[model samples]
Target: MAEAELPDPPSQGIIGYLKMVGPGVILGSLAIGSGEWILFPALVVKYGPYLLWAALLSAIIQAVVAVESLKYTIYCGQPIHKAYQRLPPNPMTWAWIWTLLIIIPVVWPGWAMSSATALAALQLGRLPGPQDSYLVLAWGLFALTVGLLVIHVGRKIQRTLEIVSWPLLILLLATIIVGVAFSASPSAWATVLSGFAGFLRPRLGFPPRDQINWFIVSAAIAYIPAGFGFNLFMSSYARDKGWGMGSKIGYISGLIGGRKVELKTEEMPFNVDDPENLRRWRGWLKVARLDSYLFFSGLTMITLILTTVMTYSLLVPRGLAPTGFKVAAAQAKALSEVLGGLAWIIVLLGGFWVLFDNQWGLMDSVGRTVADNFWFASERIKRWAKNDPRRIYYLTVYLIYGVAVIIMVLSTVFKIARPYELAATGAVLGLFALMIAPILQLIVSNRILPKPLRPGIVSNIIMIIGAVFYGFLITAMCLQMFAGITI
Candidate 1:
């Protein structure tokens, strides 16, 4: 593969830029699922709203990481994983590390199980019980199969996500907003707002050390807006959307509707010295930042706040703490108080959609990341797939879904873990990847890119702060789990 010239960016005003907001919307939808629906609410039920500040903080940090990671894609027309392979001393090592890191968290199928639980609740007219395990497992497997079919039939995998994301996100947000407006009291709203501001009227020592569950805390932080590796995957979405230099590199086409499209192995960065290209670069960067900050980060925070306030108001007063697979179910049952029987239908239905969309997005993203890394790291695989990245993509997707099925079976049949527990475990593991992502982005952005393209001092500082924040959380969790010491 030879170097290619960067194409001029599309000239877009506000409306045009809004039209190009697919990647961020998709990313935001991805975050809304397990994190907002499952973990954050679970935390609020146990710890109260005081710790909501952590959600805001995590969103801000991940937003910066999202932008920085996309820098590589904007400049080189390749995913950030490619840039990781460019790092000094054992580049292939980075590929293998990322492959494992991405696979571990995503393969657990937590979102699917959660989605299925919601469906089972909907069917049973109440929360599902131990006897309903088979029903949940059946629904989970069906959901996974539906996801696989959706991915296989689309023209482009990312485009399919973007289409599914927009409507589902709007519906989910609208449902939550309406539920919160009618269900949450003014006092509840005030409490949540204070929590967001870190005021915590009855301040409980940040997390009230005695009551803290480090695993849930770790998962909550890692998923405030989105998980660790998913931010890196944002670059791949940008590339496929033909943003900046990414316009030059072909994307991964879907198996059925997609005509043959070839992804280039080599990167093609624009010459920083060229003034015209520099202007185009800035224009593209501005668009990307808007999409990431406003759509991805902004929407995530809005969803998180709305859901937390609603859950805090409705569930807390009744002393109802949703546990096990009842996280979504409990919220629905609470909403029924104010909204009546309709609440059950609305909440459970919306919860199912939120979680299902999340599972679909996760499978697609993990498939892309794992396939891309394997192709980049292995010569034999690259040659075998050769220009048809979809071969590896579909294969990886099937393999991941197969593993997920096995995991779901074990959980459902053997009773190893519940839906929320599986999600929490995956999230805790995701912390390791979250801790490393910013550092990796900082290195690639500063070292590989041209001076004009490198991140500013403020961005660099935020990345370092994020890295340290996650690093500290991971260390605390490990100590608590292994050494029986709580932080």
Candidate 2:
């Protein structure tokens, strides 16, 4: 791809605005998957919506981080990790360490396992147990295969993500909204409204030991929308979409034999010497923020609100707490109660889509991140992925699904919650990245980006808030890990 081949600037007005919104939908759809559907609601059912504050605060803070990260690709056609590789004092070390810590957990098979459990319960009465390992493994592999195939069929990763994501997003919202209307009572609606008010002032507190679980759940809430590591993937996705200077670098091709495109391992910073280029850059930046705030952050917030509220109305009242395979069946049953028996099927279908989407999004994003990071880290690593990242990408996908299948089999054999544990562990690690990513972004943006493109006071302020907010959670989580402080 040449510089002149950059995506044409949008036409003026709302139509132009709508066109700029495509990339954000991919982000939003990825954001609203298992974490919003499974983790957030699960937590809400157990502890109510007082912690809704975590989701609200995390979305805004992560939005700031996400925008800052996007600036790299928008202006320079470089993903955030490339910027991180430019960090002082052993950038390669930082790249490798954070890569393993962040990507492994997020892409782990727990999500596929969770979704399969739900599918199994919907088909049977419950998850596959000691006597049913074959069923769990088959269903788990099926879900993983479907998601992988969906992405493999399309030519461009961005287009594929958008195509798959749009229907899944629409289906989920429609099913949930209709379910809410049919089942949620007048009082249930009122409680949801009041829950928003209650979020402002946390009226309830956990006991000393339970704080560990509280922090664990809070970490998942903060990360469900945008984790520290996933933010980088968002930048990669934008780059692939030809958002700004990113257009200069072409996209990844589909799994089938298509035109093979490869990004040069070297960095190609956007030349902003001319004032006209700067003007166009600013326009692209506005488009980026619009998508980041309204679509990526905004849509995620709306979805979380509905899922949490539904859990409160249906599961909390009935004293149901979703764990392991029960998350899918229990939530589906709650929807069935409101929308009738047929609605259970809808919920199950939605759950399966969300889970499959979640797995697909994680596998693709994390795999791309690792491949990109390797490709940029050193020339030797670049050739290791065969100079064509699609190889590394598919390899990573296979490895992730393979591991997840093992987790499913183990869980079935032992009747344990291994997938959930891996997911929760990943969430905690991802949140730790969330705490550090903004601080890194703040430093990188000021150091690398030109004065005109750097973040302003308002963005910096939000980044600070994000750092402090995520920092506190990380501190508590660390203390819990080391000091054996339960809470």
Q: Which is the leading candidate under TM-score?
A: 1
Query: Which residue pairs of candidate 1 clash?
Result: none
| Candidate 2 lDDT, 80-106, residue by residue in tens | 888888776665686686767666667
Identify the leading candidate in terms of lDDT: 1
Q: What is the lDDT of residue 356 in candidate 2?
A: 68
Per-residue lDDT of model 1, residues 358-401, tens digit only = 87788888888877777667778878886578888888888888
Residue-pair clashes per candidate: 0, 4
- Candidate 1: lDDT over CA atoms? 0.83
Looking at model 1, which ten-residue stretch has the lowest summed lDDT? Answer: 197-206
Compared with the true structure, all predictions reach lDDT values of 0.83, 0.72
Residue runs of model 1 more than 4 Å from their true location after superposition:
1-5, 199-205
Look at candidate 2 and tell me the lDDT of residue 283.
Answer: 79
Q: Per-residue error at 419 for model 1, in Å?
A: 0.6
